[model samples]
Target chain A: MKKDEVPQDDANVLEGKLKTLKYATNEDGSYVQVQTVGWEPENLALSQAWEDIHERLEIIAQDIAAGKSSPILYFMEKCLMEPPMLAKHMGIGTWRVKRHFKAKGFAKLSQKRLEKYAYVFEVPVEHLTQFDPTRTS
Target chain B: MTNKFNHRQSAHCENGVVSNLLYHEGIDLSEPMIFGIGSGLFFSYIPFVKLNGNPGTSFRIYPGYIYKRATNRLGIKTKMRTFRNAEKAMDALDANLEKGIPTGVQTSVYYLPYLPSQYRFHFNAHNIVIYGKDGEEYLVSDPVMDDVTRIKRSDLMRARYAKGVLAPSGKMYYPINVAKDFDLKPAIIRGIQHTAKDMLTIPVPMFGIKGIYKLAKDVRKWPEKVGERKAGLHLGNLVRMQEEIGTGGGGFRFIYAAFLKEAAVIMDMPELNEIADGFTKVGDRWREFAIMASKIFKQRTNVQGDYQLAADIIVDCADQEKVLFTKLRNLKFPA
Candidate 1:
C-alpha cells in the first residue's frame, strides 16, 4: 500500500491509544514503516470473534441458571478452554472434569478440588462456587 | 535500564524482536531483512487443528523458528531454553537481565495486561523482549506495540506459562555471540532459495502454495458443509489471520515484498524490483479476498456468489504465488 493510502480508520480495537506498524510504499516507491491505528476489516473480524465468545458465555450462563450445569461451566467458558485442555492443565482425567460441569457434581466437590478450579481460572474460591452470572464478568 | 538499548517496533513480534536485539549488538538489520533471512513467509491450513473452534489458517512459520533460522543462517550463535519450573525460568531470565542481555520471551497475549482489551486472547505465541527488571516489574518491548510497556513480575510469569495450544512454558532465547563482518549476500541468497523451495516444493497438501488452494476449496464448501453462521465465523477467522495486527498487513505479503526490494538492490538484480512490485500486487489480491470474505461474513452481499468470488481471489493468490516462487526458484544468483 502507498504510504498515503494506509488506512487509519480509527479502529476501536486499538482503543485509540495503541498504534500498529504497517509497511507501505513511499512517494519514492521505497517501502517505509507506517503506523496505523486500525483497519476496518480487521476490527470487524475481532468484534465477530468476541461476539461468538459472548454468545457462548451467555448459553453457559443459562445452563448454570437452569441447574443443568454448574458455575464451573461458566468459568470454563470465560477462560476460553475446552474440557480436554482444562483437564490437561488441572492434571486430571477429562471424564472427571466433564463430571464437574454438572451442578450436582460440583456441589459434591472437595475443598481442594474447588481451590484448584479457582486457581486455574484465576478466580477466588468463593467466586468459583458462588458465581453470579447476572454480574458482568 | 541497559545503556542505549533502543526498542524499535515492527510489524511482527518475532521479526521485531530479532531485529531489535541484533541492533542492540551493533548489527543493524531491518525487520523485513530478518524476516526474509529467516524464511518466515509461509502458508498452512490444518483442518483438524482448531483455534477458537475455527479451522487453523496460519500465514507464517510457527513461533520461534524465524529467530532460530535467521540467526543460524547468519552464523550467529544463540542459546534457547524452556523450563518445566516457573521459578527456575524467572531466575534464569533475571540472571540474563543482570548481565544486560535482552532476552526474547514467548508469551500468551491473554495474560499481557498492557495490550488493548480487545486484542487480548488465548494466543500463546506472541513474542516480546524483556530488557530490564525494575523493582517488581519487567520492562517489556513488545514488537507490535507502538511504545515500550512494563509488566509486573507476577503477570509476566502468568503470560510465559499460559496454557493451551503452543504453550510457551517460559521459553527464553538470546544471541550469545555474533561473528564480525559476516557477509549478507550468502545469507540473503540462501534465505530466498529456502523460501522458494518451501513454497513451491512442499509435498503436503496442507502446506505451501497448495494450502492456499486447499483453503480456496474449503471456502467454497463452508456454507454448504457448515451452517451459514459457522461458515461466516470461519471466514472471519481467515480475515483475522490475514489482516490482524502482527501480520504487517496483507498477511506478511507486504513484508515479503519489502524483503524482495531490499534483496534486489543488495544482489544488484534489477529484475527483483519488478518481482517485488508483483508481490505487492499479490498482497493487494489477498486484501481483496479479505474484503469480499468480510462482506459475505456480514451478509452485506449475496453469500453464494461472493463465496465463489472469494475462492477465486484465493486461487488467484495461489497461482500468482506459484508463479512468483517458480521465478524465484529459477533465478541465478551471481556466485
Candidate 2:
C-alpha cells in the first residue's frame, strides 16, 4: 500500500499520535535522506477498525439501557475480552461468569465479586456498576 | 533537541525501530529490508495456548526477534540490558540519552497514552525509542506511530513494567558498533532461504503454511466447538492478530513485497520486482480473507457466509503462499 508522507516539523506537531516515515535515496553518488511523515492506507484501515469497534460499543451501551443485554457484555467488548478470560481474570468459574452476564444477577453479586470484576476491568466498583459511557467510554 | 536521531515511522514497530536505529548508526536500511533480513514472517495457531481465553494465533514471530536477528546478521554489536528496578531503568535510559545515543525500549501498549484508546491492549512487546528528554516527558519515537510522541515519566515507567506473557522487564537496547562494510547479498539470501525453509519445511501441523490450513479447519468448527458468542470472539481475535499491529493487510505480505522491490534494485535484479508483484497478489488474498472475517464478525450474522467459507479462503492463502515462498527460495542471483 502507498503510505502518506508528511514533513516532520519536530515531534510536537501531531500531538504525538500520527504515523510518519523518512526516506533515503541512493540515486546519485551522494546519499541524501529526507524526512517525512503521514498516514498510510493501513493507518486508515486500522482507524476504521477501531471506529467499527466503538460503534459496536455504542450499540452495546444501548442494549444495556434497553434491558436487552447486561453491562458485562459492554465491558467485555470494550476491553477486548471473552467470558472465559474474564472468568480467569476474576478467579471465578465460567458458570459464575455466565450468571454475572445478566443484569439482575450482576446487581446481586457480592461485594467481593464486584471488587474482583472492578479490578479486572481496571475501574472502580461504583463506575463498574453505574457505567456511564461518557465517563468511561 | 539533538537532530542526531532521524526517526522514521513504519508499518510495524519492531522492524521500524530496527531500521531507524540502523540509520542513526549510519547504516541505512528500510523497514522491509530489516524485516526480511530478520526473517520476521511467520504464522502459528496453537489451540492449546490460550490468550485472552481464545486460541493464540500469531502472524509474526516474537516481538524482539527481528531487531535481535537483523542486528546480529549485520555484525552490529548492540548493548541490551534489562533492569530489575524501574528507577535504574530510567537512569540507564537517561545515561544513554545524555550521550546523544537513542535507546530502544520494549514497552506495553496498554500504558501508552498516545496510542488510540481502542488499540491499547495488555500487549507488552511494543518497541519505541527515547531520543531526548524534554522536561517531565520523554521524546519517544514509536515506530508504529507517525511522529515522535511525548509521555510522562510515570507513564513510561508503567509501560516498561506492564505485566504480561512477554513482559518488557524494563529492557532497553542500542547499537554499540555497526560494521562499516556489511554486505547485502548473503544476508538477503540467508533471510529468504530461512523463511522459505521454515514455511515449507516445518513438519508440525500447527505452524507455517500448514498452520494456516489448520486454522481454517478449526475456524470451520469454531461455532460448534465453542458456541456462537465464543466463536465470534475467537474469529475476532484471529483477525485482530492479523489487522492490528501490522498483520491484517495480507499478513504483511505487501510489506515483504516492498522489501523484495527494494532488494531487486539493491541486488541489480529486476526480476525480483515481478516476484514482488506475485506476492502482492497473495497479500490481496489475505486482505480478502480479513474482509470476509470482518463481515461475519461485525455483522454477527451467519447469513452471507459461515466460518467454513472464511477458513477456505485462508486455506487458499496458504496454498498460494506455498508457491510464492517456493519460487523465492529457488530463484538464483548472480554471485
Candidate with maximal DockQ: 1
Q: lDDT winner among the candidates?
A: 1
Predicted candidate 1 versus true structure: per-residue lDDT over B1-335, tens digit per residue: 54346889999999999999999889999999999999999999998898878999999998888998899999999999999978888999999999889999999998898999888878899999999988998999998887888999999998998877899999999999998688899999999999989988889999999989999999899888987888889999999999888888888999999999999999999888888888888988999988888788776344687888999999999999999999998999999
- lDDT per residue (tens digit) for residues B62-120 in model 2: 78889888888888899999998889999999889888999999998888989866567
> In order, what lDDT does every prediction score?
0.89, 0.75
Model 2 chain A lDDT-worst window of ten: A24-33
Taking chain B only, the TM-score of every model is 0.98, 0.96
Error of 1 at B213 (Å): 0.7
Clashing pairs for predicted structure model 1, backbone only: none
- Which pairs clash (backbone N, Cα, C closer than 3 Å) in model 2? A6-A37, A18-B146, A19-B145, A19-B146, A20-B146, B242-B247, B242-B248, B243-B248
User: Measured against the native two-chain assembly using Cα atoms, what DockQ does each of the candidate structures obtain, in the order listed?
Assistant: 0.73, 0.15
Which regions of candidate 2 are displaced past 4 Å? A1-16, A19-137, B1-4
Model 2 local distance difference test score: 0.75
Writing each residue's lDDT as its tens digit, candidate 1 over A1-137 gives 88888888775777765789988987666799999988877878888888898898899888888889988888888887888778877889989999999999998999999999998888889887787877654
lDDT (10s digit) by residue, model 2, range A1-137:
32222223342333445533333223221112233332233333344455556888899888778866676777777776667656756767878887877787777888888887777666788777787877833
Best by TM-score: 1
